[model samples]
Target: MHILNIGILAHVDAGKTSLTERLLFETGVIDRLGSVDEGSTQTDSGEIERRRGITIRTAVASFTLGDLRVNLVDTPGHADFVAEVERALGVLDGAVLVLSAVEGVQPHTRVLMKTLRRLRLPTLIFVNKIDRAGARERELLADIRRRLAPSCVPVNTVTGIGGRAAVTRPVGSTQEAAEILAERDDGLLELLVEGGTPSADLVRAALAGQCGDGVTYPVLFGSAITGQGVPELLDGIGTLLPAVSRSALPDEPARGAVFAIERGPSGEKVAYLRLRAGVLRVRETVVFHRGQNATYDGRLTALSVAGAPAQREAVTGDIVRVWGVPEIRVGDHLGGPGPAGQAHFTPPGLETVVRPRVPGQEPRLHAALLALAEQDPLIGTRTLAGGDTSVLLYGEVQKEVIGETLARDFGVEADFEPSRPVYFERPAGTGEAVEEIQRHGRNTFMATVGLRVDPAPPGSGVDYRREVDLGSLPPAFHRAIEDSVHLALREGPHGRPVTDVVVTLTRTGYSAPESVAADFRGRTPVVLARALRRAGTIVYEPCHRFEAEVPLETFGAVTASLAGAGAELRDTRRRDDTWVLAGEIPAAAVHEVELRLPGLSHGEGVWWSEAAGDRAVRQSTATR
Candidate 1:
């Protein structure tokens, strides 16, 4: 059977898990489909995920789709664990982007659709849960066009209304599919205008062009419940999506990165791998590394796909399980034969941070969190000194999933403290500040620093420059003191990552017959804090870039709201149907606009935001 790796992605509660169950049962892989509410889908194997009716981890299962062998990865739909989605995408040939017919385009929808487009993976939209009331196919379709790039086209239609959409191949040039093609090249447009239709060969060529440039998305309709359109959905997966030639696959070096790692029931460590350009066969010896250049060799004792051990070899585009690999980690790239090109496995952006909620189980909480983090690289969890822990996240739903997983997945209860992100304060135009230090010990390490801090443009990164004489203090004491300065500004006044800022140490004077422990330790914090106060530093604000479309009449309202949120209106343009606005706005003020913009547009709007540089250019949602 031909293998196809596909991802089921969507906004939360949009029936992504339900759709997975539907695919499993209809294919005869399961006796009966399990419900998310009932907490029994194979993909939702973790107790927390099942009880919460949400997906936090990415789970892969295999079953046949008629003539095709599909490895379906049911990804958490919430923005929280976008890491799982991004990690899973590395192994997928294409994706089935699921959506709720009732909800239409949403926040997560905008983000994932953009991601799918960027990766250039051929995508099929499965508008699920059409059987539910108020499931507006026409409205959602319109919104998709309004908010997304024009290449997204509906290839099939849902008949009989209520989400149980019937399938239709396509009729004429009037369909959305035509629009997807027309935007990419004019030859197809000419063919559509020429007569009835272009030859299938011509259309296939056009589709390829569209897919290559992220100019087209094939939209399919189906309902997971009623089993409507499931047949065509199965058939379409084989035909419309062309497989990359087997020979075309690269003969990569023996380098595999761990994207998802787990422990089997017998306490065996299993690493789920996406060969980031590599080769491995049975009994091949490889290194299990511990950070920088430290390692131990181990044979690949086992190999499998979707928990079913395989008889053959693992390849790129195949997600397989490997045994006997130790200290394997996400983002670890293994390549050899000269200087290696390190490939980073940066999963989708995270939006959730969680602290455990179980009683008297803090230590177990760290274990559970680390276990998940090892499996998914995107879940960055760090424990700071003073017993503070930090989790880098993408969104809210992921936060909840992490908490539930602590108690239910690994049997731990955790208490979450207020999250304090690393902060940075950058130069505000060479504003000068002072530092004075004296220790309580017999010899005090006193140093005065005339520092200038200037705000750098966003994304420029933190830069530290020393204007003072490097040899001013005793060699060892001076180095120790500068090190403290670096640590002092980690949590900028704003409580966020400090970026694009420059700190200059213009002057330094120190008295030091310094002792290592008492003198240096006592003076570091005092002088650092005093220096910060003297500079009168301003908080480095977070900036976001967003694309917006609204009725012409509402443009004024949109701009006004942006201004109220400390946004500088940057770009304005007109395209096929609506007006597009792009600009950089303070992240703190964005919550107001996000809540108000949809209301201003009468419930028809799309928004996506990421950290932007000092300068951001916003364009039409369909421009890309």
Candidate 2:
């Protein structure tokens, strides 16, 4: 049997979970169908996910479709959980993009479609909710072509009669398909020019082949709730989408990527692995490679698949939940010796300080949060000087959800302060600072180092180089200085994370009265701080780039609200009865704007924002 690792994705409330349930039921993977409304989904079993009726984490399930083992990943649709979507994208062989026919293409739909094309993943579009009163497949298709992608070709069309499923035609003979096929193939183009018709087998073969080539997309219409066109959808999954290639011989070494880290039912860390070569066996030690000359070895104690019993081994092209590897992290490569794949995620634009509601629970709260951070590294938690913990968030909803999850999962009641926009510090000028071992009286540490701080371009990030001769200082001492440089930059003079600067060691001298690596490492921070103080630093607040669609009558009010929030309007255009406003706004004001948008536009507005990096405004006088 072939293995198909697929992902179901879409905008929020587009029936992605509903479609997942339907697929599982149709394939006989479940004894009964589970409803998302009731929170009975096999994948969305988390308390927070069920309570909010939204998927915050990616969920996996398995099913069989015509002798094919389909490993399905159900991903969150809300833009707030884009990190979850990104992780799922890395392991998918194909995707099913669910769309609400009534709403057509949305902001997130466009975002996801762009990523799908960028990754060159074969995608099948499911126009869900066709049974609704105002669902128009034709108009939706046109909108998809104009806004999403031009390569979308319809494979099935819905014929609704009085809000009921009338029929669905297998759309084989169409001018659009013929044109797309002809454009891709010279023989088909020549035959079409000569007024020759291609057979059904030839057309189907061309369509299926081009889908995996990333140039063609297949569209299928159905109501997942009513099971309309689900069989055809299954057929499409089995036949249209490409399966994982069995290129690795059985004798090849084991290889896989860790896409997720989660605590299993027994409260132990479980590494969700996707094996691409060889086999993973129980009790066998696996090597994890994370690139920086870092490698960890852990034994696989147990292996299990979604919706399946525990297995002693998992073969090539399979996903398994492996236990006994507590050190495994997201993006770690197992068995194979190669650089870990980078996760595509935007940095958190908003940050909030989380405090324990109960007194003296700081340690527990910190440990719980640290564990959560390990599972979702994008969360970005930090420990402040006052022992308060700050967590980076995507939005207010995510903040609330994270707070609730902490209380429920870890029993740590917490409260969050008003969110602050995360800022980065950069050097405004260049200066040098020198530290001499003789300056410290009665101290045995013997090291002398001179470092220079220089300004770099906005996005250049922090860089360190050695300007002094190699033999001037012992290699251990030099290594300690380099390590201390990185630690010192974590919190700059302004108490913000530093970026866009270059720090170079200009001079190095060490006299060992009785010295160790710690001597050089310990004193390096003081010298680096002195240099940063002399160089001076500026704080830059992140800005969120926004695109809003508001009714024409509410345009003035919407623009006024945005202006009140320190937004800089970049462009404005009219789209039928609505106005499309594009601009950048202070990240600090995003939560306020989001709260007021629905009321301001009378629920007829749509807006989305993404991090626009940071721009320097003024010097930060505040210090931590």
Tens-digit lDDT string for candidate 1 (1-624): 456777888988888888888888888889998988899888898777778888877788888655566788889876546666766776777788788777677666777888777777777778876677677766788778777655566656655566334333443454346546766678777766776566656765676556544457666667888776566566556666655422114555565555576679986778776554455677888765443434567687778855345545765455678887766666454453222222222222223234445445556667777887777655667676654456765433455566666666687766554332222345344455554555565745555555566676644555667786777656666655556656666654444333456667676665544345345445554554555445444443335666688877788888888887778877888845667788777544555677898998877766655543332222221111
lDDT of 2 by residue, 1-624 (tens): 578899999999999998999998888888788888899987787988887788888888999866688999999988788888887887889999999888778777888898898888999999888888888877788899998888788988877622776457788576668787778888879888998888777877888998987778988988888888788899989989999753447577888888888887779998887888887788998788875446999998888865356656787778888889888888778875554334355567799999999999999999999998877877888898789999998778888888888999999999999998887788989989997776457754577778999999766667788898888877778889988898889899878888778999987777665667887887788888999999998888888878899999998899999999989999999988999998889889988998899999999889888665666665433454
Clashes of 1: 23
TM-scores for every predicted model = 0.69, 0.90
Clashes of 2: 0
**Model 1 global lDDT (CA atoms, 0 to 1):** 0.64
Worst 10 contiguous positions by lDDT, candidate 1: 615-624
Tell me the lDDT of candidate 2.
0.83
Candidate 2, residue 418: lDDT: 99
